[model samples]
Target chain A: MTHALAAKGPTASRPKPAEFIAFAVLAALLAVAPFALYPFFLATALCFALFASAFNLLVGYAGLLSFGHALFFGGAAYIAAHVAKVWGWPPELTLLAATAFVGLLGLVAGALSIRRQGIYFSMITLALAQMGYFVALQVPFTHGEDGIQGVPRGKLFGLIPLGDDRVMYYFVLVVFLCGLLAIYRIVHSPFGSVLKAIRENEPRAISLGYSVDSYKLAAFGLSAALAGLAGGTKALVTQSATLTDMHWSMSGEVILMVLLGGMGTMTGPVIGAIFVVAIPEVLNRIGGPDFAQWMTVIQGAIFVICVLAFRRGLIGEIAARLRRTL
Target chain B: MIPLLGISTQALFGQLLLGLINGAFYAMLSLGLAVIFGMLNIVNFAHGALYMVGAFAAWFLLTYFHIGYWPALILAPLGVALFGMVIERTMLKRLAGLDHIYGLLLTFGLALIIQGVFQNQFGASGQPYPLPEQLKGGTNLGFMYLPTYRAWAVVFSLCVCLFTWFMIEKTRLGSVLRAATENPELTRAFGINVPRLITLTYGFGVGLAALAGVLAAPIYQVRPLMGADFIIVVFAVVVIGGMGSILGAIGAGFMLGIVEGLTKVFYPQAANIVVFVIMVAVLLVKPTGLFGKKL
Candidate 1:
């Protein structure tokens, strides 16, 4: 058992230079893409990619599926928006406040949810997030349906003016890259190997003297913090936060993003996030207003097909085929 | 002079009655989930959608076929069970050897389809299902007035929940189910048809949800989105009760409902979230849940 566990550890801890190079190329493309594609659209995709990658950290690597991650993402957005708009904090400080607040919330939620495994864990997280939704709906500070609107983007470190859409797009790209790197580092860390051990066999890990619950809770917090990073950035870019962000459907959309990309693969979630977010926009441009709501139908179809036919996901399948050829 | 720190007796009784009514649906739905999970080891995420279908089925029967409430109650669950059987046979059967998450995903997809189609046909707005004339009136207790239909719903659901509990905990067939839940292969070797039992178990669970939906139609309007949020709340209830015990589920449901009602009386803002709060507290205190066996 120890031999088997030890063998699994090195693979997770070693980071491939190829993966980092691929990310760098992807980052370069994204950084330059606003010149060709719409900057706002590019920003939106970056925000969602960050969110999906954070979500992927939990579901893909640790094997703990949280269906309520929108709470962290959207809840932190509300916090960051409120702090920036009301407290007049610098953009960086507000982002920090939001990330910390979300990380704490994730700790509490993760600690509670890790008590149950599999579907029960998913349900508990979802229910707790719904609870957060109810609180947001009734709370006075959220501004009810309108949310905190016209949130000032404020200066990055009170220096670089993010007022320009192009500048803001670059700012969002940088944040997304930073968050993605953090996720990649976590997934390849020694702690990450322990998490994978717990995921593969909780009982054995527990029996082997590892504190399984703590590892799971840590992973959850890391995932939530990264999700908060995305949400906080998005709130700044969009200049508002609303109830829609905290909704369960948002949670479902994130799951779809991760599933479509490839769970456990570094490149898969980024690709998944781009496709899931951009597809609806593309469809709207082509099909017009009447077909906008059809996005849900399309998303639903993708989720079904992914689960039924392509469980390994886009990147995982490609990697497997390449390996077979090699 | 009225007592301090005491609500009027009438108001208290009324809230308690309302609590019992909400608890009835909770008991029925959670029981169905427990049964399905026990036998099939799969959580039916579509349980709520199936329940919504039951309410919609009843509405369709009334509007389209001119069927009354009694006939609709019987037909709605039967229709849902038939639908569940079809799902088990076609889609769910394919997922037998996969991880439990795949089963959940499949059901979730089915739920979206069912809810989406219904949403397309009937907009988000709710349609009223008239209370049957026989059950339209109220019974005047000295402390509070109880609507006859609400009373019947509570009593009838309690009976159904207990009947199910007894069947699973006491009967020979239930013993086989319990045995199968522990060791499907061993039970199969003993000549039990495990796969058929799984389909029927799913059907039974779906049927229970449909029955609850029929019961709920008169209280809550028949709406496409009705089951969506309720399912999430029921999930909290299941977590709090520790899905391992049927009696625990029923008890926790009524207990949490009363707590929720009390929250409404004191702090209405927290009522919607009180059950979740309790769930968190339960997790902190006893992670395995009050009656749940250790994982």
Candidate 2:
């Protein structure tokens, strides 16, 4: 296990000029995506894109396969929805509040879980997330199974109304881009290098006088905050926050997106999220009544195929072939 | 109806019995997981799915071939074990010596496929498996009325768990299995067929899960998602116990089940999350798990 992990080395490499071009092209495509597609669908996909990026930050960059990340993602959604519907906060404030709360939640969860490594880490995080799910289920504000429904999109920054689908779509896109950019910068920064070092060889990092646990916890918190931002934005777009977001399966879905996108690559998560989010929507549109079943089976097949043959993921493979870092 | 801590003795004892039954399943499932993890170095995420398949196989046997519970108990696990061995041969074999997470992901995918297919076929509702004729009635044990099937399940699962522990810890083959787990290469150099050993171990572990499923079918509603719901809690049990020792898994399984049962009696709202809470506490205090050796 140690050798296999160390062999992965650091995929986070020095930034090249072509990477900028790819980023710009991605931004331009996303900016015009809503014009061609359904704005609601685009917004949802963008939310998932951000969610997957946040997940990749921990799994890809930090080498932490946190199986319970939905705690922050869905936990933030509930908080965002509650603040929006009950506290009547502005959209920005709601998102900020939820993101902050989940960031702290991540810190605590990370602190407890980082002591264990590998499969133990995954199981601990999963148990904690399942605990969070139970809290969401029993807590009164979540309104039990019905969830906090009809959440007001509210005005952005107290001035710009975001009720319209096109306006909300743009809001989500901006947030997605900012979140993705934040993740990209973090990946390239000195801290990200340290994280990669820790991932590659924890004992060696410790020998080098690095506080590996602190670094891991910091990365976990940051990843969690970004996931919360995505979740908060999703609540506003969808106009509800449900238990589905916090479910363990939601955690699995996010992991799937990151894996499908190419775990360590900058553009992979977004591409992966789009595939995952869009596949079900498309299936629902075209398939018969049993499509939901097929959707799960197909998702499972993708997981198996990705692990078996496409471990580098879509972007990772392309980058390898092109001999360039994506 | 003697009052104990402001609750009826009957209710308390009844919940305790239910907890014991839940603990029985947890013990069996986690025991299988520990054995497999020791041998495979891969967490079989498909465990719960295979357990569900075991129950379904029993259902199919009864519905199609008019087989009874006793035969299903023996045959279902055997069938599932064969399926598992084949999976190990064709799929899991390719992943040997790679990162363990890939095994987890692949098995997770298998689980989703199995669960999704069954759900599509059976819908979300549960199919009831009748209790065997002899185990239908209840015995009044003074404090509470105990269902005969539940008692049998607890006793039977405990026996199975202990027998597995005995097989892996006391027998000569068990020593070889442990040696392989400790160092596969060294054991292989000793002229043991380690790969075949691994395949059989996986099959045996999966068969244990199927046995649990058969035990649970009569008590629970035998729903498609039954294992899914139970697996997370069992994961909590594994974490709490640390999966290092077979006894730890069994002990923690029953203990947590009783704790959850007691919580239900005292504070019904917390019944669901209590095990998870204990898991967090355990992780915080002893990250290596109570019985786990230091990493």
TM-score of the candidate numbered 2? Answer: 0.97
In the range B187-247, model 1's lDDT, one tens digit per residue, is 9999999999988988999999999999999989999989989889888889888888889
Tens-place lDDT per residue, model 1, A196-243, is 787788889888787788889999999999899889988998999999
| TM-score for candidate 2 (chain B) | 0.98
Candidate 2: segments with Cα more than 4 A from true spot: A1-13
What is candidate 2's lDDT per residue for A1-326, written digit by digit as tens? 22433454334457777677778899999888877899999999999999999999999988899889899989999999999999999998999999999999999999999988888888888889988988899888899899999999989888999999999999898889889889888888677888989878889999877778889999999999999999999999999999999998899999999899898888999999999998887887888555755887888889989998989999999999998778
Off by over 4 Å in 1: A1-12, A324-326, B1-6
Which candidate leads in lDDT? 2
| Candidate 1 clashes between residue pairs 3 or more apart in a chain or in different chains | none
Instruction: For residues B1-295, write the lDDT of model 2, one tens digit per residue.
Output: 7899899999999899889989988998999899899999888899999999999999999999999999999999999999999999999888988877788889989998899898888989999998999889999988889899999998999999899889989999999999999999999999999999999999998998999999989888888898886888888898889888999899999998899889989999999999988888887788888887765
DockQ of each: 0.63, 0.82
Which consecutive 10 residues in model 2 chain A have the weakest lDDT in total? A1-10
